[model samples]
Target: MRILFFDTKTYDKESFEKQTGNYPAIEIDYLKTDLTPKTATLAKGYDAVCAFVSSDVGSDTMDALHEAGVKLVLMRCAGFNNVDLEKAAAYGIKVMRVPGYSPEAVAEHAMALALTANRRIHKAYVKVRENDFSLGGLMGMNFYQKTAGIVGTGKIGAAMAKICRGFGMKVIAYDVYQNPELADFVEYVTLDELLASSDLISLHCPLMDNTYHLINRETIAKMKDGVILVNTSRGGLVKTDDLIEGIRARKFFGVGLDVYEEETKNVFEDRSDEILEHSTTARLLSFPNVMITSHQGFFTEEALAAICKTTLDNAVAFEKGERNGNEVEERQ
Candidate 1:
């Protein structure tokens, strides 16, 4: 089973190579080029192609992969929103992903972002480096006794709820399907109620048609004044322009985003040398209260190992004509 791995980074190569020895039947070739329509032809001799969250797997790329004799698409990450599942299915290609690989890693990063942004730690660090620690605008509120609203109640959201509880916060969640494990401490509320009541709101939902732009102008207007917003999930969940308006209107005390609508162009890449003339990311960075990280919420060591193992397991399962329960289809 020859697999071509696209969008290869140093960390990705290191992680995947460390686990390849465990799957001797599967041989992988790494490529730094991203999986686009043009690069899809590189998978001509491979049985499968491994991709990450940032790789493009649209209709054209799917067609190229099918023509190149690629049978399977292995998403090393959980989200398959980038993959055109319907097109892949139409081309007789199977898709699989590593779902819930170290949920705590992302959950912890969400909390870190919230804390860092809220307390102005990034600013403080810079000021201290310049020997100008006057502490003129480092004021921050306590999270204790505050309300934390979680937008999703999956594994990562559940873990975030636990962390919020540990901070002595009143945890409320708004999800279509509630996790029963949170019944004891967490309160399930309506989306409107959560937006109006929560002092801190963290988004952890998938980006689907209904969930696309979930946080926009209307929703931002519903939030409480001086609310802290954190998003560690998919980028499309929050409308970037509306968020900028909210920031300008002083609706947010701070904003921490691991993912944003325009992140695809800058994710895992250093654009410091390039001129970002019309970049929304550059505009977002101009704000002092907005803290954006590369899409690295799931970059922990444990998560990387789990992702590699699951990707290989998916490949082995497909080769043996079996389902490992990670198979993604058009209906999924």
Candidate 2:
């Protein structure tokens, strides 16, 4: 099986190449360019094209891939919101993804961000580096006995709940379907209650029609004063403009985001030399309370190895005409 891997980075190449030896029949060609309508023709001779979360796989790209004789679209990441699922189905392209590639890696990163932002660790580190060890504006609230509201109780949210429990926090969650395993300790609450009560709120839900901009103006208004907001999930979940307004109103003590709506053009790319004029991300960076990472919650070594193994396994299954339970289809 021949696979054209798009958006190839140094880390992605190193991880995938190390795991390719296990699947001898798979031949992969790496391309640094992202998968788009114009780049779809590059997959003419390959059976499938591997893509990341930032790749554009809309209707036009699907049409081009169909014309290029590509039958499969393998997403190396968990989120498939970027791909047009209905168009892929119409084009007879099977889409598969790595859904649960290391939930703990992301959950740990979320807690790390919360701690860093709340304690002003990033600022303190820079201050100490300049030989100035003053301890002003570094006060942080204790997490003990505070309420931690998890927006979703999926694998990653569940892991985050456990971490908060270890910190002696009261864990509350809001999900349509509650996990039975967490019923013993987690309190299932309504969205309003969670927003009004939680001292710290973490979002771990997928981006869908109903969940789009879930954390907007109204929701932010419901949150407790001096609340800490963290999002390690999809960027569209929070409305950036509304968030900025809430920040200006002094609604948040600190905000930590590993993903944001404007991250598509900047993810995994170095833009230090370029001026990001008219960028919402640049505007968000001007605030001292906001800390944004480059969507790197799943960049750990364990997560990378697991992602590589599952992606190649999915490709091998497709070649053999077997379903591996990772296939994604459009919902009716």
Q: List candidate 1 segments past 4 Å from native.
A: none
Looking at model 2, residue 140 earns an lDDT score of 86
**Per-residue accuracy of model 1 over 1-332 as CA lDDT, tens digit each:** 99999999999899988989989898999999999999999999999999988999999999999999999999998999999999988889999999889999999999999998899999999999999979877888999999999999999999999999999999999999989999999999999999999999999999899999999999999999999999999989999999999999999999999999888888899888999888998888888888899988998999999998999999999999998899988875
Query: lDDT scores for all predictions?
Result: 0.94, 0.95
What are the clashing pairs of model 2?
A: none
The per-residue C-alpha lDDT of model 2 at residue 274 equals 100
- Model 1 worst lDDT run, 10 consecutive residues: 323-332
Model 2 TM-score relative to the real fold = 0.99
* lDDT at residue 57 of model 2 (Cα atoms): 93
RMSD of each: 0.8, 0.8
